[model samples]
Target: MATPTPPVVPHQGRRRASGALEGEVLAALQRAGAPLTPREVQATLSGELTYSTVVTILSRLHGKEVLTRTPRGRAYAYAPLTDEAGLAARRMHKVLDGRADREVVLTRFADGLNDEDAALLRRLLTGAVPGPW
Candidate 1:
């Protein structure tokens, strides 16, 4: 009797991120106010990614706490845990908090500021009185 043939299976491995795709996905999620399924996210992404690829990216971001997911039947609805600005602030705080010379670090940061930003900083500093409010 002829031996039965085994069905071919696709290899499963880690998917490496493309910078453009990652940025596009993140931007889409940021623009959306509610959780989005993989299909919905892919649809808003201008068809730049496959459904599976989108799922993989979402899963990776979810693992990193960059995004949160809620169960919806057999799939998940994903949303950004924090906005870009919030994420940046969190990262900046994490880095700055670990430094030995926070004041020097802040001074360097202030020194590096552009004219408009420096002017804004000056205004903010001048507007704040030491008292309470």
Candidate 2:
């Protein structure tokens, strides 16, 4: 009889959520404070992720309009358009833009906000210059 091959073992680690890799890549770019090539980004990630994986993530982020790229030597360098807060706002706008009933959506969103956030929103709507978040 032929000998059976040993079972393949899965890597032991906590599962990463969807988009987690993208987020990590974005964070690395943001921390860089300047555009970085795929290899640089991979190095910034401490080589935890593969070079091709970093390139793919950067490409995906660029495709999503979250990042901008420019030609740098043989490879393109990537940079984020804004900080994390701006990205969050963009996501919120995207969600709102997808709905037909914007008013209802806004109302529900406002209603779900806690008192502190509601007050902050109220101040923002009233053109009041609020303090730092």
User: Candidates' lDDT values, in order?
Assistant: 0.85, 0.93
TM-score for every candidate vs. truth? Answer: 0.67, 0.88
lDDT of 1 at 15: 56
Query: How does model 1 score by TM-score?
Result: 0.67
State the displacement of the C-alpha of residue 8, model 2, in Å, after optimal TM-score superposition: 4.3
Residue 114 alpha-carbon offset, candidate 1, angstroms = 2.2
Question: Model 2 over residues 1-133: C-alpha lDDT tens digits?
Answer: 9999999998878866649999999999999999999999999888988898889999999989999999999999999999999999899999999999999999999999999999989999887966455
Could you tell me the lDDT of residue 95 within candidate 2?
95
- Highest TM-score scorer: 2
lDDT of 1 by residue, 1-133 (tens): 9999999999977655576666678889889989999999999978867999999889887876788899998999999888888877777898899999999999999999999989877877898535232
Q: Model 2 reaches what TM-score against the true structure?
A: 0.88
lDDT (0-100) at residue 131 of candidate 2?
Answer: 47
For residue 23, model 1's alpha carbon misses the true position, in angstroms, by 1.6
